[model samples]
Target: MIQPDLVELVALRGAAHDIALHARKPVLARLQGAHRSAQRGRGLEFEEVRLYTPGDDARNIDWRVTARRGQAHTKLFREERERPVWIVADLHVGLYFGSRLQLKSALLLRAAAILAWVATMDGDRLGAVISDANNQVSIFPPRSREAGVLPVLEGLVQAQPKQPGEESFNNLNKLLTTLKPLLQPGSLVLVLSDFSALDDNSETLLANISLHNDIRLIGLVDPLEYTGLPDGSYRAGLPGRLWWLDGNRTRRLWQEKWAARKKYVDDMANRLNLPVIRLDTANPVTEALPQLLREPSWQI
Candidate 1:
């Protein structure tokens, strides 16, 4: 398996550009055309016809439909354009663990890079919010394809896990709160994380963001996380302070906690009408991303 590095992350742009152009049309179409407004505009796509009201524009009258119905009707047009796309990546310590191909942190960065490249290729503005365990940084949406993606890739290259004495665990809620102001309606928001840092406040922020934007949560999980540890003695925890996982008791308890955590995230996502994609550390992102982009929602 290829370890994620700055070079690999940057190289994703070319692959993503290709995928966006050919394979992801279903998802891209949905993301680009999801927002529809009833307000009359100069947009070229006709949406629907409605009964003419007193304030309705006379020029928009659908003469053919009006003659058939024997009543005045006005045509509505849809706004045809691409929406902004933002990626939020969590690089907390919890994501530093993996039993397979790459660390969750590495996977997160790779995934974000691909999404950013895809967004740019689709003619959508691109932006990102990244937390490096100690600090959070954001790149405002930029229309230039390369300009929109380079900063995010640079941020991933510089990211590091929080040291023992660094600022307390990065508050995902606070990060989202700060990001709220920059989000625009109908935007596509992708959150990549292990979701070990979620809380009530984070849920609330996600709910609010989903009200006006299309939000998808991408969960990164290691095989050890989804499946319980094998029954055997193993060292766990920080360096020089490890504990033994000697029996089924510890493994079962860990599994139970993981299940609970998974349930919480799933419930919250469902309540907020958010779609979730779970990827394992063992799978290459190139294999997983196409499926995500070809989801049925995008075909609509």
Candidate 2:
């Protein structure tokens, strides 16, 4: 049987569903950044009129239509534009394993797939920088239509962890440092990772990237990492070293480590004011991601 740890292209392609994420107009993406487009005037063509929502621009309110309708309406516009969305899937060696339904790597890639689908469906371009163990990095430049999304999906499947967890040589700091230059000011970036090893250096790199682009951190979490093992003795260790997780007493220490990891993410998000979507391996990310994206709770 094919384990859920493996990335399935067929399943990913099918994961694309009609995701309507609009406040008033059909936005290419709901992930808004600080970099606003400079060009204005005749370039903006009128698209339609729709009922005003909380986030809709007050300047766009149609006063004439508002009086007749008894409720506020806003004008929506369609400009000759598309957003560039970049996804960084960190399938480092550490994310290879899961005691739940899917591996952390698999869940991360699935979130990547859904974001690619959602962005492309709304007429945005897609690109990616996918990293794996052994220092393999697959970089795809932004492209529209299937040209943009297919290559990313293929790259994600290729980089999916082949086995259980192990020490990783992949460096997120170096990757983000190198990636910061390539990102356009207004680009939407999704970074999918477990991020258990992020330190002060890594946090600085991410903060620099967030300064220009709209970044969403998608955290890949497996239930076992926080829950620990059932009440039983288990042998666990690295390739050359071995240790035993014997009882509930030892398991508390295991769970405490995960708690620390959680706090690290929370602190980073709070400091950077970045939106975070935690995708658990136990839950189907394909379902959870869409709802998470649509919620106002994650809006910064």
Candidate 3:
């Protein structure tokens, strides 16, 4: 199969546009429009008219409507601006493996790129935090411009997966801890990862982050990771050195581990009240992404 490249990833802008056209779905609506701020203040758009109450501001009274109906009425307004959107993508060694369409790294990058484009199209500022084994890079919130999505996509293109032995250095929790301060309240935060690296501390930090921000977790996995291998010996490994999986027992154990990891992630996300969308490498991102968006749980 052809490997995904920067050009392909960058083209997700158009894919996002296509997805937005299907706005009957709540998730698509959220992705395609300016996010309504929870706080109502000045500079908001008129939402509706309601019967005036004791505490209603007199200045907000709709005199014409009140005079017509002969009853006091007040205007309600909706926050008119879009909030910043942050994409946090994991580039650890664990994401480098895939048995099908694309590597987990590629899928994560593609998903991030698509969301970045959607956020930009909806008139929101875009930011990103990308982490590998020993390094974390951040692109501060940048106003959406014609080419706003390019920088984040470029970073993904340039990122290299961590070496096998360097897995211990994958400190996603530290990266997230440092990122927490930078996120503005009410911002939308999308974390794309296999989430196999999360520990107790990471879960705590994620929960804390969710308290102030809208957090969505996208879990990337390969078919092999979810389904056990067939009953047979198979050779696998890097170029210089190789190893063999001798029997079905080993495959079952591997599948059990993957299932446990998936459960851990699911349970943690549930505790944090985070919405998670699972993406598989067995299918093309274009196909997999829309399916995820269509899910009822994809809504805020």
> What overall lDDT, based on C-alpha atoms, would model 3 receive against the true structure?
0.74
lDDT by residue for model 3 (1-300), tens: 444567988777777874531224357556645543341222456899999999989999999999999999999986656566788877777677778877788788788878888778767678877776446665555557546678878777777463443365455775687679887677777888888788888888898887777787888888888777778888877657789886586877887898899889889888887889888888777777866776666544
The positional error of residue 26 in candidate 1, measured at the CA in angstroms, is 10
Screening candidate 3 with a backbone cut-off below 3 angstroms (N, C-alpha, C), the clashing residue pairs are none
Question: What would the per-residue lDDT of candidate 1 be over residues 140-219, giving only the tens digit for each residue?
Answer: 55455788788778877677453322334555666688779887776777888888778888988998887777787889
- Give the local distance difference test score of model 1: 0.74
What's the TM-score of every candidate structure? 0.76, 0.77, 0.77
Error of 3 at 204 (Å): 0.8
> Can you write out model 2's per-residue Cα lDDT over 1-300, one digit (the tens) per residue?
133422464456566665622233334433442113531211355899999999999999999999999999999986536667788878788887777777777777777877887778767778888887755777888888889988888887778768655566445765676678878666777888888768888888888887777787888888788888888888887666788777677778988888988998899888998778788888887778878877774432
Could you tell me which 10 consecutive residues in candidate 1 have the lowest summed lDDT?
Answer: 34-43
